[model samples]
Target chain A: MIAPLVIFDLLLALTIVALAVAVLCLRDLFAMIVVFIIFGLVSALAWVRLSAPDVALAEAAIGTGVTGALLLKTLHHLRYVTGRLGQNAARGLTAMAPVPVAVLLANAAFCGLITLGLAVAFLGAPAAGPGFEGLVAQAMPQSGVEHSVTAVLLNFRAYDTLMEVVVLLAAVIAVWQIERGLSEAPAPVMGVVWQGFARLALPVIVVVGTYLLWVGAEAPGGAFQGGAMLAAVGLLLLLTRAYVPQPGHRGLARGAFVLGTAAFCAGGPSGGQRGPRGL
Target chain B: MLEGFGAILIAMGAVFFVAGTVGLLRFPDIFCRLHALTKADGLGLALIALGVALLAGTAGAAFRVALVWFFVAIASATCSHLIARYARHGAGGVP
Candidate 1:
C-alpha cells in the first residue's frame, strides 16, 4: 500500500499542475487571477511539506496574498479604463483573442522540452553528498543567531542581504515615481463591517509580523516574512480606504520605505568587522 | 484519544470544504453561492483549527492556531459582505 504521506505529496503535485493549466487556459481575467492565487497557495503548501516553513511563509504572504491583491486592483483599473474605451473594446479586452495555432504549438513544444530536461536532470542527480552544513555547524557558535538560516542571511551573507534591501528600496522608488504621474480618485469608504474587521485584524497582523521578526533568531521566521506581513497591512488599508496617507505623511512614508536599507547598510560593515563568517 | 478526536474533526472539516466547493459551483446566483461558500468554509476552518489546537503540544502553538482561525474568519466575513454589497448596489447590480 502506498504511504499516506506519499499519496498526499502526489495529490499536491497534481493539484499544482492542474492549477497551472487552469491559469493558462482561463480566458476570463478575474478567473485567471483567482486561479493564479490558488496556485501560489498550493505551492506554499508544497514548500511546507518540504519542511521549509520560511519559504512557505514568504510564498503565502508575498506570493499569494499581496500579489493577488495587486492583481485584483490592476484588474479593477483595467476594467474601468476599458469601459471608457467603448463596449466593443471592453469586450475585446475581457475576452482575449485566441493565439495563433503556430504560436501555440511552438510555445507548447518549448515548454515540454524544458520540462523534460528538468525532469531528467532532477532524476539523474547524484545522492546527497557532504555539503557546507558541516562548515556552517562549525561556525554556528560565532554566528550570533540560533537559527542557521537567520545567521546565514543576516551575518554570513550580510552584504548580499543588504544589496537585496537596497534593490527593494529602488523598486519602491520606481513605483512611486510612476504612480505620481497618475491621478488616482479616492477609493470609496468601506462599510462598517469591513472597517470593524480591519480594526480588529490590523493589530493582530502587526503583532504577528513583529513576532516573526523577533523569533527569526531562533526559528523559521525572518525579515522577509515580517516585511511581507507589514506590506499586507498596507494593502489592506488601501483596499478598505481605512487609512489614506495625507500629504503631511508623505515624507514619513518615504522614510519608512528607506529604513530597511538604511538599517542593513549600517549593520553590514560592523558585522564584517566582528568576524569572518561562512557563506 | 485526543489524536483520534482531532482526526475526526479534521475529516468533518474536509467534508464541509467539499460541500462548500460543490455549492459554489452549483448555486445559480452570486449571493447564494457566496452565502454557501463563506458559511461552510468558516465553519470548516474553525473545526480544523480547533482540532489542530487540541493536538498541539504547547499552549503557545494552540493559541497561534486559534489566531489563524480568527484572522481567516474575519477576512471571509468581510469579503462575503463586501461582495454581496457590491452585487446589490454597484454597477451591473444583480436584481
Candidate 2:
C-alpha cells in the first residue's frame, strides 16, 4: 500500500542525494555535465513522487532539457579555452584543492541540512490552506480535466502558466538578439550515423509532440509539453547544424520568438481573473 | 506487484549510475568513459523514471515522470555529443 510507495520515495530521495554527490565530485568537466543531467532527471522523478506534475514537467523541460543544452555548449567552449590556455595550469589548480577536506566539509553540511529538514517535516506539520483547498476541490469537479493538479493549474492558477510562457518568450528573445551579431555559426561535426539517426528520430519526436499536445487537455501533457518536444527537434537540428540559421532562417526564428512572447504576455494575465471571479 | 517491479528497476538504475560514475573516474580515456556515461547512464535513468511512472496512481503523475525520462534522454545524448565534439577537436589531454 502506501508503505511501499513511501519506501520507494525514500529510495528515490537517497538515490538523488547520491547522484548529486557524484555530480559534484566528478573532476572531468564532461563527466560532471553528464552527472548533472542525471541529477536533473532524478530530481524530476522526485517531484513526481511529491505529487506536482506541472513542476515535474517544467523541471524536465527547462531544467534538464534547455539548461543541459546551455551547459553542454558552455562546457564545449570552456574546454576549448582551457585547452588553448594549457592543461598544466588547470591540473595545478585542481591539485591545489585539498580533496579530502573539501569532501568532508561538503558531506557534513549536506547531512546536517537533510537531517534537520527531515526532522521538521516529520514533526508538527504545517497548517493546511483551507481556502486554496476549497478552490481546488470546487474547481476539480467542474473542470473538464480529470487530474486535480491540472485543474488547479489550468483553472485556479492559470496565471502562473501564462507568466511562464512570457518568461520563456523573453528568454528566447534575449538569446536570439545576442546571437544576431555573430556572422558565423558553429557547425556540428557528427558522423554519418548521427545524421541518419537524427533524421529518423525527428519524425518520431514530431508525432510525440503532437500527441502530447492533443492529450494535454485531459491528461498531463499540454502545449508547453508539446513545444518542448518541438524544441528538442530544433535543438537536434541546431546540434547537428542541419537547421543552422541561414539568412532567411534567422529572420524566421526571431519572428517566431517574438510571436510566442506576445502570446504569453496576452494570455497570462487574462486567466488570472477567470477561475474564482476574484482579485 | 507493480510497485515491487518499480523498486527493482529503481535499484538497477542506481547500480547503473554508480557503474557509470566509476567508469568515468577510472577509464583510461575520455571516449571510453563517455560511452559508459552516455549509454549506461541514459538507460539507468530511463529505467528509474519508468519505474516511478509505473508507480504513479494518476495519469498526470505518470506523464510527468515519463517527461523526466524523455528529458534525460534528450539532454544526455545532446550533451554527450557536444562533449565528444569538443574532445575530438583536441580540447584536453596530457598532450
Candidate 3:
C-alpha cells in the first residue's frame, strides 16, 4: 500500500479499536450506545475501503441506523418503566451491565483465541475456495436474475429466505403474546419544523425504498436492504408522530410478514426454476 | 480539471468531518455535541457525495449518490432531534 493509504487504514483500525474499548469502559449507557453507533459507521467505512460495498451499506443502514435507534428506544423504555425519573436513562442500563472481572477476562481470552484461529484459517485458505465462484458463474445464466447475490437468495436459496421470513414472523407473534396487548400510540410530535419534515421526508423515503426494490433485481440492493429501508421509514414516521399504524393492525403486520415468504415460495417454481437444471 | 475539483471537494469534506469529531469530544454539553456532530457531519457527507457524483460516469450513478446523501442527512438530523427531545423531557412514565 502507498504510505498515505496505509496510514489511513492504520488510523481507521485504531479508531475502531479505541471506540470498542471506550464503549466497554464507559459507565454511562447513553454515551456507550452513542459510541457504538459511531463505531458501526466507522466499521462500515472500513468494509467499503476493503471493497465490500454491500456489507458497508448493510452495516451503515441496519447496523448503525436501525439497531442504534431501536436500542436507544428500548433503553429509554426501561428507564421509564423502572421509575428512574430525573436520572439519565444511562443509569438504568449501567445498573444491569456490571460484569465480574473473572468473566470479563474469560471473555477477552475467548475472543482473542477466536481471532487468532480465524486469522490462521484465512491465511491458509486457497484463493478460489473450491471453485464455488466458478459454479455460480456457470449457473448465472439460469438464475433468473442478473445479480448473483439476489439470484442466490431469491431463487437458488429460496428455502433459506422463506425460513428467515418465518423466523421474523414468529418473533413478532411472540412479542405480541408477551405484551398480551398492543402497544399504545406514541405521543404526537409537536413543532412546525418536525411537522414539515415529516410531510417532506416520508414520501422521499418511500420513493427511495421503491427504487431500491426495483434496482435490487439487477444490483446489490436486494430484499434485505430494500426492506430494511422501508422499515426505517416506518420507524421514522413513528418517531415523528407522522403516521402510526393502529395497534389493531397486528393482523395486517402478521400478514405482511408472511406475504413475502408466501410469494417467494409460490413464485419460485413458476418463475422458471431453471436454476438447478431439474427443479 | 474535474478530477481535481472532486479531490478538493472530498478533502474539504474530510476537514468538516474532523471538525465534527473535535466538537463532539470538546463540546461542553450534550446538546452542543449533538449540534456539532449533526450539522458538520451532514455537510461533510453531502460534500463528499457531491464530489463522488462529480466523478460518476453516468447520470444514474450521480443520482444514486445524491439520493444516498439526502437520505442520510434526513436520517441523522431527525434522529438527533429525537435524541435531543428525549434528553430534554423524559417520556411515558419517567416523570
Q: Rank by TM-score, descending?
A: 1, 3, 2
Candidate 2, residue A168: Cα displacement in angstroms equals: 2.5
lDDT tens digits, residue span A1-279, model 2? 578988998899999999988987877766777788988888999988887776787678767876687788665554443353246434422433456988989999999999999999868576663646666777676776766655665556676776665566566666666655542534546565467668868887889777765576676766665677677777776777775557766676556665655654565322211110000
Q: How would you encode candidate 3's per-residue C-alpha lDDT over B1-95 as one tens digit per residue?
A: 99989989999999999999999999999999999999899889988998999988699899989877886787688768766876786453232
TM-score of each: 0.85, 0.63, 0.80
Q: Residue by residue across A65-177, what tens digits does model 3's lDDT show? A: 77888877666655554454446444533465468999989999999999999999989898756746678778888987787777787777788877776676666667667
lDDT of 3 at A87: 63
Q: Write down the TM-score for model 1.
A: 0.85
How accurate locally is residue A74 in candidate 1, as Cα lDDT from 0 to 100?
A: 77
In order, candidate lDDTs are 0.78, 0.69, 0.73
Superposed model 2: Cα runs more than 4 Å off: A1-7, A21-27, A81-133, A141-144, A183-186, A264-279, B1-95
Task: For each candidate, report what fraction of the true interface contacts it reproduces.
Answer: 0.44, 0.00, 0.00
Measured by TM-score, the strongest candidate is 1
Better of 2 and 3 by lDDT: 3
In model 2, state the lDDT of residue A116.
97
